[model samples]
Target chain A: MKNLLKHHETYVLLVIIIFSAIITVINPRFLTLENFFDVVKSYSFIGILAVGVTFVLISGGIDISFTAVATVAQYVMAVMIIRYGGNIFTAFLLAAAVGISLGLINATLIYFFNIPTIITTIATLNIYYGILIVISGGKWIYALPGWFRAFADIRLFTLCTDEGIKYGLSIITSIWILVVIIAWVILRYTKLGRGIYAMGGSMNAARRAGFNIFRTQMFVYSFTGLMAGLAGLVQALLVQTVAPNSIVGKELDVIAAVVLGGASLAGGVGTLFGTILGVTLIAIMSNGMTLMRVSSFWYNVFIGLIIILSVAFSAYQRRTKAKRAIAVEVE
Target chain B: MRSRHSELIILGCITTAIFALMWVFNPNQFLRIGNLQNMAFQLPELGLLSLAMMVTMLTGGINLSIIATANLSGIVTALILTAMINPDAPPPGSGGIIILAICAGLLTAMLIGLLNGILVAVIDVSPILATLGMMILVNGLTIVITKGYVISGLPNAVRFIGNGVVLGIPMGTIIFALCAGIMALILNLTVLGFNIYMVGSNPTASNFAGVNNTAVLIKTYIISGLYAGIAAMIMISRFNSAKAGYGESYLLVTILASVLGGTSAAGGFGKVSGLVMSLIILQIASSGFNLLGVSAFLTIAFWGFIIILVMVVNFISAKVLERKAA
Candidate 1:
């Protein structure tokens, strides 16, 4: 038990349980299985982005452009559906392709130019978002086809309770989980994954070790783009509309969640399980706030504070660990 | 420094070229007095925000919360102004109230800035994450306080700051110029300014040289926050209202302007004159776009493109300089 406590994930799990327990005590409605599923389903989109972003962060880069890329891809998907009578499969394929291309734009620019990743991505974010707005005439697409909206209605399991029937699982949630598992395996087993860690840890060392920096960066960004595209589709289907402006600025939330899950912004660290916990914590906080009838604005305030505190706590942990290691070496 | 001067010249050329092109396309309207005045008025808010961005960038950091800080300060001042004034009274003797409100608003901004400085300098959080948190926190606080409603019917003083003109020049522009001039003096002459550049250039080296790096960083962010406060004053008065989400789009443009003005993202390099020129170039481009019936949204894409273009130009110039040296 004490050994398990040494893991950051275990501590995160404990925090989640305690937080949920407190919220449940205050508002029992939050404890319902229905609400649990709702939280998981609602956060699934962010979860998918977080999964890909974990790779980028671990590889020692950041991509603020994913949200913009996702926005453009989703807009295209919507346009094709409503304007051109495109099928679901065609829309997904096209969106994924567009997303990959957009991701390549970011990867190639950063790789070739050797510019700072943050500035490069910020520039791309604006360009992609602005282009989408101009192309779409800044109009919201509302009339999505019925099939697309209802595309993910498959329930993994259903439970009948005294109150009502509730689905224990959803296809959307399953997709998120599947991605997480796949990403976990890739990070743990693949050479490219290990290469990413080496690159992020030290660029010169990684290059000296014969790790291809350009290819690794290209793969990292493209992977993020691909995930953003898939998440965008899920978001549109879930909401039944595509508001171009809505998705552009939420990259902060994803970054915050990834960082909160024990990922260092400085790179060379992060995990799939840690990211899941982070996403869940954020989702639960929002859900709890809504359930408590608190003003939504306060929600952002709390999130901001939580992000600062979480990052600070982790930094402190790393510092103490370093100090302990030094003390042992001295002895 | 040579590169900085060349960047400024390049920006000047770009601005003039755009102006000439616009004048040729529509000379009468583009050079009309009314349009010129309007452009002067439009330049300051973005100019001030960009200035604020440059200050932090000089320390090799960024304050993403500038827009949010501006909004929150404006909202605080608005709340004070509206709460103190009797609704039935028309612009009553409330000069003192206006002064008090402005102070409160500026104080609020400074406090927020101090929090950001502490987080980044003391707690050692990444500047991006720290400022991003502050942005969201303050934005949320502003929204909660205002209930997502716009606060209007500001005092006459706001009109003077926002829209008033003296000797045919806009008050906002005057304020921006004064602030920019003061900032230039500080950067060029003050010890703090020298420290900022040194720390930004190389923190470890500066520390070894006995420079107070943390103090410099804290001071830099505080100055940035104070600039945001000043900008809030201009913005609130100009719009005759305040809201939490107003100027939501200015954040990116401010960064764009700063970068275009020759502020390096990796830090230790920027110029006030360069930033001023960049602001003029963007403002003219935007005004020209409006005149040409181009979608205003497209300008954002242009701004993004311009950053990349400037970087490319800088890269080429650096390469040429290297070859010449070799």
Candidate 2:
């Protein structure tokens, strides 16, 4: 019981429960099982992206270019499928390849130039988006093959609400869950994952420990790229249109969710469970606001506030803990 | 100091090279006075923004909220100006109201900067995340206020500041020069400037040496905010309107310009002259491209490529210098 109380995930879960209770009190419809699935389905893309970023963050690097990579990959996938008539497997393969290549480019730049990850990613983000826009002429791709559209309707289970509306666990949500499970297993049981944690904890120490820095970095960034690419496909499937610019600005939302999930920006600490809870909290907040009929603009305002406050709270806690440790040493 | 001088010379060479290339491409149109004046008018807003981003970079921090603060400030001034001055029946003492509105805008930016400073320096949050949050918050507030619509119809005097010419120099250029001069003085001559470099280079050492790192950081961000406010004034005046999303693309460009100026991404090394030179180089290239009818999107890609290329060059040069010294 004491151990559970000390966990960041516990607090996140508590907040989720209390916040959901408040929202349900304000709007009774928010408590419906249908709304639960709706929120999960709507935010599955973000959850996937957050999971990918969690790996990068825990590896002591940041990648703001993932959204750009996702867009470029999905754009290529859409173009390929639309023009050549490929199956879903082909589409996924194309996206992952594009994503991995772009992610490798980011890794190569960081490794060779020794530039900071944030700076390198920012530059690449623009480069990728600019090239995409220039080549595509900012055109939105529509009329995806019927097979691709049908893939979105593939749900494992289905239920009917009182109003005869069908709500079920979606393939997208299942993909998110599968990604989380894979990430959890990797972080907990894999040597590569241990190397990532070591690198984030201290690069010099990790290097001294015989951890291959380049390989870990390559894996971390490319994993993010892969997830981003998949998320991009998921987005198109859900929306049924491929807009070139739809996914760029949501980088902050994903980063915020990951951070709120107890991932230190400085690196070396985070959990998949914590990240999922963070995503759920943010999704719930936005969904609750929509139900409450608040202005959509206020959604970003609240997110910004939550990011500052939560990070500040953690920093304060760390500072006091350090002070207390010093006091004990003096005694 | 020697390295700084060399960096400036390199930047100067690059600027001249681009200018010559543009001239060669379009000798007839590139050298026209009208074209030069147009470039001058367009340079200051971006120039001011680059400076805003530069100062924060010098402190080992970044103000991602700089553009958002600028837009919100411009919106605040726009709201005041539109409310106070009736375009149909202009008031006699409207200039005072315009000044007041401008002040209000600057104050709004300062307040946002203060919040960002508190979050970063006082609360110990990372600079990138803190300013990013502030950026989103400010942007949201601006959206809420303007409801995603453009505000326009400013009085003539306010427009004069952005468009007026004096002694053959554009008003915006003159304002940019004055601001740059002030910025140069602040970074080079002031105690605060010394402390800023010290804190950025080594925060623990500076703290041990009795520097108030928190106060210095707060002051640094406040100055950054002031520059953003000044840029906002010029932006709104030149466009003759204010909106929630003006200059969204400028954010990346500012970072690019700062990096191209030889500002160390890790902080503690930069120069105003270097930054000014890089800004001119960018303006020349962008204007030349416009004359060449190149797509604007390609130019953006080129800017990204240039940032990465410059970093690589800097790294190689530093390595060569180290080897030579050995």
Candidate 3:
């Protein structure tokens, strides 16, 4: 029972992969480069945010305002690059600054006022969306300079593979990969990462253990915000335009991917690799549905069902394990 | 007397300041009586939603899908009205079907809330996940049932309920106030409300103290669902239309009202009276901006900024509590 509880994420991953493989064999298009690339391109930015936000989730905090934060970052970048005549480097930095500041705002509220993360995030979420509207004045900014869009040109920049990034390896995809690797290293090797997990397991206990939880929380919120900023930048650059309302309902998809990827809403358990797999699983589903020409109407239904089933089963398996352990102890 | 006076002062200070600003700025030009009526008309769903938010939150959980349920309820009402009214067949504006359509919506919303409660309380899914799951499912169900279309042709009686006013007060505002009063009454005067607070404050401890945690949690869900239904009815009546997408944003606003009003998102503490004030505060803030006559786009940020300011106030108040506790 203990083993299963510990390794349920692994099992979920295995099952999903096998399912994907089976689907691939049945429909060769799923294996084709075009479909796979499409999946990568579509899911990369969301995948990046999921990987970052997983840190906050595992630390027993939720950041529901990330979509708003991302939108703000996108707007800042658009305004900087086009209206202000700023270089791409300056634009990206400005965007990142906006995100980090947002994260800091959230952290300060939860830590100082002892306000709940949910409430704080909800407020900030609106604030960011507000920024989006106020900045654009309810209009789309379409004429992004050429230099800004150049960021999307390198699919993989002639990486070790022949498939160019636009066909597969876009800058956003590469940067997301880099983030995953960096996060993995931090989680596996750094004391700060351990502090994150410890805080999630039990903040009181973590504090008793002498971990600086306030500091850790601040760092987590900030890190996630920075990543959200990066995501917004990529999204802005890719489309060569910014729409204030583009990501209105996308937060759910990102959260679903995080959960499906084997992270717990309860905190203290999840991996970058697991989240990546989770993002892929969702991306695959989205891709497959598109390939099948399913109505957008059904996409939400299927996705929603998948999210509920995955989480529900995980919860059920947990109770079953507790029952078995009690029986074992009795024996 | 001092505390009561202070709360009254705070409420008056906040609301009156907003009113002074709007009035000083000469709001009646673009903020016409019609727009004011429209705003009042919109408040029922938001008000009912805020009440539901207060109850669930009093139990220390959030139902992120209230809007979805409300949306679904709206769909059901539309469907029910259509089936009864027959837009093509007769002198199609018969009004008797109005009450029936709204009843169906409320019942459906209540059922959905019951399901939400069962999942969260019994199945042990966190309320966030459970309600979120319901949100996604309900949203899609709304689309599917409506076939991704707006279901209009509301019974004139129902449409009258949405459009009609009594003594210069829109039906939506009247309904909103009525629901708010009911929720406040139940929470303050009822045994069920007491149990909900006890259970939410500490589940294991509450159970040890003989409070039934599962029952309490389940009841909150029921209340939450009923509020959604009420909100759904108001929305259909006011718009004279029920789109699958119409009620999507109310969930956020109502929840904001609850949390901003001094209900701890952590549960175990809430005041519907405070929520009422908070709703008024939000309405005033939006109304003030509308009065200012700037781009309505700033409206969202304006709301967000107000919520953030409310939290700032909440945080300071918590510090005061901590000092007193010490």
Candidate 4:
């Protein structure tokens, strides 16, 4: 068991340590308070989404459509804040609605046809992206309303001398920090959360034990959708321009992060804390790589190599567990 | 048995409705030689990718690398043609120059396909994971070779193949039709095709019955790769220059065509002919929208609509079939 846990999240931690040591030696700007704040805010969007996806994945259900759902949220919000006189609050709600709707569509397809979760989500990914394309007519919407900018205002922990409070954390950063904490708490110390672990381990066993698979799947998918919606809003603030194509193929990174963070792509394993660490590690790699001006040429290759190795290691761990289980049964 | 055909009937109905929409809205523009030609050239990649998808789906695997493979081949062919064929001066016959380029591009893609097949079939990796790795690798390879630049300057012959038809018929249309025809024949008529279908639909049962599942899988990947190469040749010749993002937009559309055309993602039951038809239908829907001057960004939404409609139709058909069975 200890061996398994070590293998699960060990890669993410090693990456974090390796990058931290390298970046610190290479440049100290990586450890600065200001840069750290920016990283927190930027990663919160991905971090939160990863948390929800972790839950769904652990339950052995995959949701590839979240990126599409998030795209829908962004498109709607882009149109609303720009055209329909929608405020940040209203836009957020609408984004969430769009997310939940897409999620429901995925759940419906899976249940109605007994389709595999991966296939269902794959089909819906196109559906969501396709819908976005149709609605936007391949146009980009910029110039969101001013109130939408207020979402970025959450500031905390200023780094300033007695003379001037020049470097303080933003409200957005604080909110992201708070949300990550809350997510960790709800996932680790809650009964329903434990149910997720139970369910992901074995669907048939969970069902035979009278677990409500539909409700769990519906909730998990909707929750992931909501996270995607929230991520969309954060994305809007971070980039300050609504890019329809900005995050099209980002789910791969998210899945990579979750898997890197010690969450199993095979399900029934993962933790909130590990996910945050994984997200932070990726952030550092991307941010530091950019800061160092690593050859734009080798950057993707480097990152892709790490991601492949990390996931391959995760699969190896799962296989060991499977073999062990079989051995136990034989015994 | 009737329930099984529910997806087919719905797909047929939707296809007919699209045909009607084109005829009703702007029959002149919709039913034009030029438009038909546009679709014929435009759909080969989608058709080829769908076949690739069918292989993976049959084996309970999915390859997300189809576009990457296609794009990689396109760029490589373009690069070779421009650099090798006419490095110093303009050649009198560009057609011959391009033919050599096409051969190189298709061969390279097939080589990549061979890699994908080995990774999935021999390594025992999940099809999704195996192809995902290949996708990143190919995309990287493309970026590495091209440095993310568009390649122009193909032999005239190649360009002619893309733009010209066999005496009033565009070569693109003929090539695409020939591909579909060949695929349909091989899939329905040959034992190799039967083995592929068998492996994809029920690996365990097929294994017990002595089917060589790994060999079947490897063949499918190679075939898909070869198709990607062929599709790239068509695309490059048509454009006269290999664009930077040629095959990126094709994966989803191809997968959609396969599903919407009534190939079960579950595997054993799919028809290449149906997939080919569905590719044409997709082309028509998008082209029809483009003609209407609708914001093409909503192409995603349109596809979403198609998928949902396909699903709902499939759902209703299944229900009706069940009722009839009852």
The best candidate in terms of lDDT: 2
Q: Write the per-residue lDDT of candidate 1 for residues A8-110, one digit (tens) a residue.
A: 7776788789888988988999998888898898888999999888889999898889999889989988888787776778878977888889999999888
Candidates sorted by TM-score, best first: 2, 1, 3, 4
| Model 2: DockQ vs. true structure | 0.70
lDDT of 2 at B238: 93
Instruction: Candidate 2: give its CA RMSD in angstroms.
Output: 2.2
Model 2 chain A lowest lDDT segment of ten: A322-331
Stretches of model 3 off by over 4 angstroms after superposition:
A1-5, A18-22, A83-88, A157-168, A323-331, B1-9, B27-39, B87-97, B321-326
* Each model's DockQ score: 0.64, 0.70, 0.60, 0.34
Model 4 chain B worst lDDT window (10 residues): B1-10
Model 3, span B101-174: residue lDDT tens: 67788889889989888888888888887788788888888887878777777655676666789999987788
Residue-wise C-alpha lDDT for candidate 3, range A78-192, written one tens digit per residue: 8777767877689879889998998898898889877677778877787778766775676888888877767667666433334453355667677777878888888779888
Candidate 2 docking category?
A: medium
- Candidate 4, residues B1-326, lDDT tens digits: the string is 55546556666777889989977888679889888777776666567667767656656567777777888889978887878676446667765666777788888888877877886676565666667656766776677777778888766666777788787777877877788788777787887788878887778789899988888888888888888787778777777777545667567667667776777766787777667667767777888888877656555557656766666667776677679879
For candidate 1, write residues B27-78 as lDDT tens digits. 7799998999999999888898898899999888999999999999999999
TM-score of each: 0.95, 0.97, 0.91, 0.88
How do the residues B1-326 of candidate 2 rate in per-residue lDDT, one tens digit apiece? 66567777777777888889999999999999999999999999999999999999998999999999999999999999999898668899987999999999999998888888888899888888889878878888899899989999999899998999999899999999999999999989999989988988989889999999999999989999989999999999999999998998789789889988988777898888888988888888888999999878777777788778778877787788889989
User: In model 4, which regions exceed 4 Å deviation?
Assistant: A1-6, A31-34, A75-94, A113-153, A160-168, A262-266, A320-331, B1-9, B87-100, B298-300, B323-326
TM-score (chain A only) for the predictions, listed in order:
0.93, 0.96, 0.90, 0.89
The candidate 3 chain B region of ten consecutive residues with least summed lDDT is B1-10
Report how far off residue A288 is in candidate 1 (Å): 1.2
Model 3 CA lDDT for position B107: 89
Give me the runs in candidate 1 sitting further than 4 Å from their true place: A1-11, A82-87, A322-331, B87-93
- For each candidate, the alpha-carbon lDDT, in order, equals 0.86, 0.89, 0.78, 0.73
